[model samples]
Target: MNMTPAPKAVVVGAGPVGCLSAIALAKLGWDVVVYERRPDIRADSLQASSCEIPARIPRPRSINLTLSARGIAAVQSIDSTLVERLLYNAVPLQGRMVHHLKGNPTPQQYDRQGHCLYSIERGLVNLIILETAAAVKNISIKFSHKAVGVDFKNNVLRLCNSVTGQEFDENFDLCIGADGSNSIIRHFLMRATQMEYSQHYLSHEYVEIRLQAGKNSSGDTFLLDSDHLHVWPRGNFTVVAMPNKDKTFTCALFAPREMFDNLQYPDALIPFFQAHFPDLLSLLGEKRLLSAFQNNPRSQLITVKANLYHKGSVLVIGDGAHSFVPFFGQGLNCALEDVRILSALLCEEKGGCDPSAIHRVFKHYSESRHEDLIAIGDLAMDSHLKMRRSVATWSYTIRAYIDNLLYALSESLFVVKLSQTIFGPESTGWIPLYSMVSFRPDISYSAAKKKAEHQKRLVDSVGISLAILGLGYILHAFINLNKLL
Candidate 1:
């Protein structure tokens, strides 16, 4: 009797997204191996490499994030325990605390009722996902192994271990690239098939700075608000802070590249920080500020767009497929959801699918996800403008007011329901891109936009009705007073 072999999956990159992808696939009974270009992230300690940060300098580790309900729901779907563990260490950001031009009466909150995002250290989050993947018996990890290139047509991969100049060829039935923006796997797959791709780097450059904690007499921590994301928005640039598990904060100065490049030395950095972000200088201190400016790397923000993310046995997800600017704070969240969607699709196919099935599913994913990814990417870019300028605009304020009203009405007023009920969560699941991409399983990005559009229209209709009713009431009161006269 002859026995068939289990289909194998090769995942490139051992980052949070990659690790999660491997674990998700393993859960579906696929033989999986994950490869990382760098040494083990679990063993390495990097300081505020990602955008998330804490409140106070020489501070302990903290991360800046907007862990919304969408992201939370996605993580919970796969591993509720993991979500619990994350929440146990997570800091809820009820809303963004927008610091107005100095001496403003009050700060702005993102949501009136206090529904905020979250702040979670990138390092710790990656560690948890990696650890979870390690626990899965069917998943294997190869650290310090970099993919030099790949032959997508042959389903073969060439990898080099950094420590040793050892090279090897591995054949797999499928390859999933989570290798980040500059994905070698993606480049290889594109060569074998017709793939459309575009990448754009924004004019912005981000510099991460430390804000040391102030100790109380009891050796406790003393600082400003610890429960909110603090943003001091300047016209052209901004300084933002996110709280850490510890008693400190990580602050970042995001400015145009030209501005950063013009200031070449540590001393120049001090003056720049003082001029643009006065309070941060006092918090970070001159010495530490200089060190961070001169020593630490300046992060560049970019948007990567790919037409098709898969071909034959090779596929791409996460940063490899769609990496947007950090303004939206959706990169990690979206990447996590990508795995959930991919896993659900592959699981639906079951064991009977051929090698091309995975590739075909990915093709569908790219097409369906393209609009949402583009929309979010565009939204992220637009948000940078909104954060800096539109927060005070009349149009923005009216939009915000209408948005809140609709959300409240949807939850409160049951008499008139939204159109979503007709489509339902499954049929219209494609419509709530946020719900589908970030919350539900197998729904594409484009579908979510359609749902959101429909929801927006409903909100608009209600708003118009309210406006007209107010006008009628005012006119009626005037006529009654005239009759009395």
Candidate 2:
């Protein structure tokens, strides 16, 4: 009996999204090969356990991602066991702890029902996903194998072995680019098709700052609130920190290019911190802050969008298709969702894992996924404005409070009463934009954007109307009291 061989797929970029794609394909009876330009991170016989706490994470590049519902669903969809492993290495952030310039820090919970986002290191996520992909019998992860060229017509990828300086051609039934914002596969794909692409680098740039574990009088690990994301929000500059399993906090400051340029020397570090972040100096200390300011690389934030996600049998997923600013904390989650969506599309193909159906599947996936990707990019950019300029403003705070209050009211009084009403229950009621985007995985990015706009208008109108009514009631009572007098 001759058995049909599994279809083959070559996935470029072994980042978190890339690894997930390979795993999904492998499970669907496809032989997969993942090519990464970087050397194998685990090559040094790095210990198996994520427990050995390093003084600092080895890699300088990390976005300090939070695993939200969309990302979590994607992970669980691939492997239920993976989420547990990732959670082990992650910190559950209940909400953001916003540190003001003067007063004490204020804690804002993400949701009334207490849905927490797990803050996990970017490197840890990739390593764990890579390990999961490695365990799959049909998936092979080749590090230091940079994708140099592509023959889209023939589904051929030209790779260069960085170690040996040798080049080779490999053919696949499908080629996937998860190679991040600056993807070689994306570059080649553009040459092959009339792909409309736009890349905008914002004035904002980020630099890493480390905070070693602090010990209290009891000698237990303590630093700020480990359960909350710490944010030092200044008008044009914001410094955010997320907890790590090693009892340390990974912090990054996002500031305008002018601000970063102004602090380009050792002497400028302390004074700038003193001017905007006076209190934080005590926690980070003088020496460490100076070192971080001097040594860390300042990375410019970029937003990327492409008109076409796929051409022929080649496709771009994750950052390759759409890269967003880190303000919304959706970069990782959005990338993970790409894998989940693509996997579903592949499964929907009538002939499961059939090589002949590749083009049709690619086209369908692109058409279905493009709008969501575009929506998220726009959402992230909008969020950048909120985080940078509006976060410290009273109007923003009031608006956020009003929005959350409305959501709580809807969930409790309105939604409950409406659902139980003889209205025959098909509605989910009002879901907050933040919840829809972060906590609600089923809501598409485009739908979430549209819903959010509608909700914002509703909230503003309701809030204004209620305020006017309250004032009217107060005035009417005063007028009646005066008449009695």
Candidate 3:
């Protein structure tokens, strides 16, 4: 009897998505190799540099990740034990605590079923995923190795050592470009195939502010609800915060570059904070707030979308394939889902280095992923308006209540009745757009967007019917349809 050889795979970039891809491939009996240009993300980028104010701040990567249903499901799909390890020290956010300028904060639960999101540092998640990938038997990680070029037809990557500057070539049965937003693999694919691509930088810039956890008068340690995500959404400009295990809140302010430039003077920041975030100002303290605004790095947000994700045996995943603004907090989740989807698709193929079979796999992956990726990109970019303006409106509040009520009555209690009445005979059940996009991994992004539009129509028609017939007029029927979407 002859033993079959394992399929070979090379994953570029050792970020969370790349690591997860390597692990998933290895699990399918693939001999996987992961290449990273950096020494070690933990030491090189994930950890703080001499310039950063906080010792724990990740240098190159600033924004923390909000892990929702899609990300959780993907991790669970990869390894059950891995999910436990990742979520052990994470902060669970049950809902958004919306802070208004002149009134009390409003708390909105994510779902009645106690659904929540986990907030973890970008560095920590990347580190954990890399470590988990390293533990896999057939996966190997190559640090300080940069992929400079690629040969799509032959499935080869031209590599250069970061420290030594020596160049070499390596070919694999399958090569995945998990190299982030500025992926070399995507570049090579664009040259080989006319891969549609677009990237834009928003005028908005963001600055991270560290809010130290407090101590009450009794000297007992206290915090601003570690279980809730804090937000001061002020229309075009906003401030958002997520809790850390160390009891600190990682707060970020998003404003136009002009605003940031105007407030460059030390004196301007406090006054701006007082006017825009007076309630939060008291908690942030004068000293820390001043220092954070002055010293913390301000960064720009970019959004990218590409078509034709694969050509030949090469494929791009994560930010390399589709990059979104952080507004909806789906960038990382979608990327992780990419790995899960790719892995599952690969598992369908027979364990052999069949070139034609692999090409077909790549073709299927790109065609299937296109619409879903485009849907997410649009949603993530537009969600900023919904978060900043609509959340505080009476219309938004009423819509939330109605959505939940309809979901319960239709989905939980009367799925058949709903299908006949409001949703046509084809309707499955009511799902709030938020629930569909963030909490339902089974539903693709494109499907969720389509269903959301249909739901909107039904809500409007019903509300109008009640009013015209002199039944109770639903004045609180949602109005910001464009922004809310």
Candidate 4:
């Protein structure tokens, strides 16, 4: 009896999302091939070894990512051991340490029940995923292989080997574009079909600065609190820092492009830092800040969205499908979630590697996942405004307090039973918007957004009623006082 061969899958890009995709497909018995434009990060001698703690290397620009419940759950689905390895060198961030110009920093916890985020190096996590992919059977990783073109009609990808300067074409049963914001596969799919694509660039640009580990009077390495994510919100812009395993902090200064343009030289940066970020200047030192400002690259922020994610046998996931700002720290987590959802959907196929069934799977995925992807994209963009300004405001803090209070009350057994008896099963549980998005994996993004909208309306109504009652009481007291007089 002739047995059917395993279906082949070609995944473009070798980032975390790409590597995860390869691992997922390989586990499903698919012959997987990964192509990356850049050389293998694992082969780089300067990169930290798998067993060693990673050190912060000075890069022109870097964006630190936080792994919360979503990312953790996705990795756990793949392999529990992988999650352990990824978090081996990560720092736990229990809350945000809001830095003020003239006062002590304030701490704002992420969740009420002690849920936290893990701060890890982006490159280190990528390398770990790469190593995991390397160990999986039936997976081939081709480095320095740049995908130049795609033939949607034939399911073939054109490539160029950077080292040998040779071009080739390869065909696959299915093609995945885990390639990032500037996805070449996405570009080809747009021309082949009616893919509604939109790209928006924010006015802000960010630059990265590394703060060396400081020593205490007793000679122990100490700087800012390692357990908190430090934020220096300055109304219009912000500087945020995350701890590293090497006792240093990786800080990124996000500001308007015009502000960056004005600070063209080292001389201008000194006064600018001293004027706005006096405390940060003292921590990083004036000389180091000046050097970073003058030397580091200023990277632009852009959000990319597409209405359709798949065409025929090709599909796009991760940043390629929905690229958003980093304020919410959901970009990487969402990408990993994509892999988990897609893999699960593929595993449900009845006929096993049926092309028509695979196409149906893709259609179902695009239709079901589009709204959630768009919802998270919008949330991430809106979060940028909150982080840079509203985070430091009293009104925002009060609103957060109310939100968390309601969520906590709803979670109590007494309240849950009372709500169910009084209202219905549907109203038995309540969760804050942030908790729904970051903590609850079972809750879909679109459902979370809708629930949050309903909660906001209810909260607003209660607030208005309370305000009116208080005003009426004050008015009545004043009238009684006048009558007594």
Measured against the true structure, the TM-scores of the candidates, in listed sequence, are 0.82, 0.91, 0.89, 0.93
- Candidate with top lDDT is 4
Candidate 2 clashing pairs, residues 3+ apart or interchain: none
Give the better candidate number (1 or 3) by lDDT. Answer: 3
Q: Compute the lDDT of residue 67 as modeled in candidate 2.
A: 90
Stretch of 10 with least lDDT, candidate 2: 416-425
Q: What is the lDDT of residue 82 in candidate 2?
A: 78
The candidate that achieves the highest TM-score relative to the unseen native structure: 4
What does candidate 4's lDDT look like per residue over 408-469, in tens digits?
77774322221112111333466887877787666667777888889999999999999999
RMSD of each: 6.0, 4.5, 7.6, 4.3
Give lDDT: candidate 4, residue 348. Answer: 76
Query: In model 1, what is the error at residue 366, expressed in angstroms?
Result: 2.6
Residue 477 in model 2: lDDT? 100
TM for candidate 3 is 0.89
Best-to-worst order by TM-score is 4, 2, 3, 1
Off by over 4 Å in 2: 43-57, 216-220, 350-352, 412-427, 464-485
Choose 1 or 3, whichever is better by TM-score: 3
Residue 480 lDDT, candidate 4, scale 0-100: 100
Residue by residue across 353-449, what tens digits does model 1's lDDT show?
Answer: 4766776777776676667677777767867777676664567667766666654555321131211111113342112223333333333355555
